[model samples]
Every structure is written in structure tokens, then in C-alpha cells.
Target: MHRITALAAATITLAFGLGTGAATATATATDDAARVAPAAFSCSPGNFCMYSDWNGGGTRCQWPDERKANTADNCSFIQRGENVRSVWNATGHRVQYYTGTNYNSRVGSTPSGQGGNLQGSYQIRSFKPQ
Candidate 1:
């Protein structure tokens, strides 16, 4: 009876240890995926571009129309639960970005011929000429 109990306890302990190890491994993988950097984006002249991931990677939305009232329903990035992490304004004029649809709640602006990464506060739901 003593041996049986000891064997049962050992089995339980080993199973618990393995489960914890697997959980840790899965968490590590998720962290690594989030930290992965996206590839560089190429923007053409006279257009504005937004990236779904940092450094101009992931899904891209470009516009030559100069104004977008709604991006949530049309943009692939928003569909994927991702926000604009970087931007490139190749247009001649500076671009104004807003947090809400239809250009409400102005957040920031990006200069023409320049681009940079965002800190995740401004998701860029709408944008237009400055």
C-alpha cells in the first residue's frame, strides 16, 4: 500500500511539472511573436501609407484620395485588430490623423516625405489633409 501511494504521488507530481513546463513554453512563444519586427514598407510618391505593424510591416493601406472618413470597416489592419504602428506620407502636404471616424478627435499629424513609428496611443481611425 505504501509503494502504491508513493508511485501515485510521483506520477501526479511529474504530470503537474510537465503541464507547467508546457504552459511556460507557450507563453514564451506568444511573447516572441509579439516582439517580432515587421519588414520595411515601400511607399510611392504623392500617396499616404499606413502600416499595421511597426517599421512598415504587416497589412498596408495606401491612399491617393487625400481623405478617408472611415477606416475601421474597410482597412485590413483594423479588421485584424491591429492599429497603425507606423506611417509614411509621401504626399506633398502634411496629413492629419484622428482617433475617431469622420475626422473627429484629432490626435497627430505626419509631415510630407517623412515617416516614423507610433507609440500605440493613436490608432489613426481617420485621416485627411492638414
Candidate 2:
């Protein structure tokens, strides 16, 4: 009788442990899905916009059909040293961005009317038409 009771208790504990692990994994997956959901696009036409969060979820800075040798000059978020995790090029031409001021250290570019999430690992300090 004692051996049977011990086995039953162990089995219940193992079942509960497995159930809890599955629940935790489900919650983690839900959280990841929420984080990756697409954010609203708010950039205006004929403008170039940069966001500090993935999928354009955080602070934004925009420029109208113009080259910016130093984005932090007038952009509050850039000035605060936030990374540019997304960009929307609503202008009429492809826009190339850089990791340093004065268009140094070229990173990438986006075509007109196209934009999406970036690697979120670097800041865009300058940008101009490609």
C-alpha cells in the first residue's frame, strides 16, 4: 500500500510539472506574438520617417524630401540616441541611410512607398536619396 501511494504521488507531481511547463511555454509564445505584431503606419506622403521601435511602434522622426546629414539635429528621438528600428520612405525616390553622420558607414536603403522593421541594432545618423 505504501509503495502504491508513493508512486501515485510521484506521477501526479510529474504530471503537474509537465502541465506547468506547457502553460509557461504557451504564455511565452503569446508574448512573442504580441511583440511582433505590426504597428500602425503614420508617416505622411512625400516624407521619410524613422522609428525607434520595431514595426514603427515608438517615437518617430520625419523629413520632407530632403537630405539629412545629421538626423539628430532636429529630430528629438534621434537626438536622444534612440536606434532606428524601422523606416518609411514616402518620398519619390529611394532613400539610403547611414550609421554615421555626413552619410558615412552606409547601412541600407528603402524604395519609395516601402518600409518595414529593421534589425533594431543600429542608429541612422544620416540619410539621402540613393
Candidate 3:
């Protein structure tokens, strides 16, 4: 009777341990999926748009048919010192952007009607038609 009771206790302990481990693994997988999920793009047509987060998530600053020598002048996200992680050029011309105001320290450009994720390491302080 003692041996049977001990065996049942050990089996219950092992089963509980496996269940806890499986639960932890499932939670980790869920967290990973949330981190890699792509955000939605929401820029309008005929405008240049900048995003504060990757894949067009977070705050957006957009200008329509205009050049901005100082994006922080009117863009709330830029004024808050948030880096532009993505962009969309919904304009008629190729748009060049820079890391410094007045077109200094050119970072890159997005051709007309094209855009995607950026390095997310620098701010877009200015932009103009290329």
C-alpha cells in the first residue's frame, strides 16, 4: 500500500511539472507573436507621410504637395523628438529626406507613390522633392 501511494504521488508531481512547463512555453510564443505582428499603414493620397513606429504604426506627420525645411515646425511627433521609422511618398515627385534641417545629412529618398520601413535610428528633420 505504501509503494502504491508513493508511485501515485510521484506521477502527480511529474504531471503537474509538465503542465506548468507547457503553459510557460505557450505564453512565451504568444508574446513573440505580438512583438513581430506588422502594424497597419494609414497614409492618405497626394501627401508625404512619416511614421513614429515601424510598418506605419504610432503617430503620423503628413504634408500635402509641399516641401518642409523644418519638419518639427508643424509635426507634433518630430517636435517631440521621435524618430521617423517609416515613410510614404504619395506625391508626384521623388521625395528626399534628411537627418538635419534644411536638407543636411541626406538619409534617403522615396520615389513617387512608393514607401516602406526605414532604419528607425534617425529623425527626418527635413524633406523636399528630389
**Tens-digit per-residue lDDT, 1-130, candidate 1:** 9999999999999898787974654454344212222226567667788888777877788877689998776778776667789887777778999988999999899766666688765578889999
lDDT of each: 0.74, 0.79, 0.79
Q: Where is model 2 more than 4 Å wrong at Cα?
A: 1-39
Which predicted model would earn the best TM-score? 2
Q: Residue 125 in model 1: shift from native, Å?
A: 1.0
Q: Which segments of model 1 are wrong by more than 4 Å?
A: 1-39
Task: Give the total clashing residue pairs for model 3.
Answer: 0
**RMSD in angstroms, all models?**
13.8, 11.5, 12.3
Superposing every Cα of model 3 onto the true structure, what RMSD results? 12.3
Clashing pairs in 3: none
Give the per-residue lDDT digits (tens) of candidate 2, residues 1-130.
9999999999999888787984654454344211221236578767888998877778888888469999989888888878888887777778999999999999999876667899989999999998
Using lDDT as the yardstick, the better of models 1 and 3 is 3
Global lDDT of model 1: 0.74
lDDT of 3 by residue, 1-130 (tens): 9999999999999898788984654454344212221226566666888999988889988888569899999899989888999987767778999999998999999876566799999999999998
As for TM-score, the candidate ahead, 2 or 3, is 2
Cα RMSD, model 2? 11.5
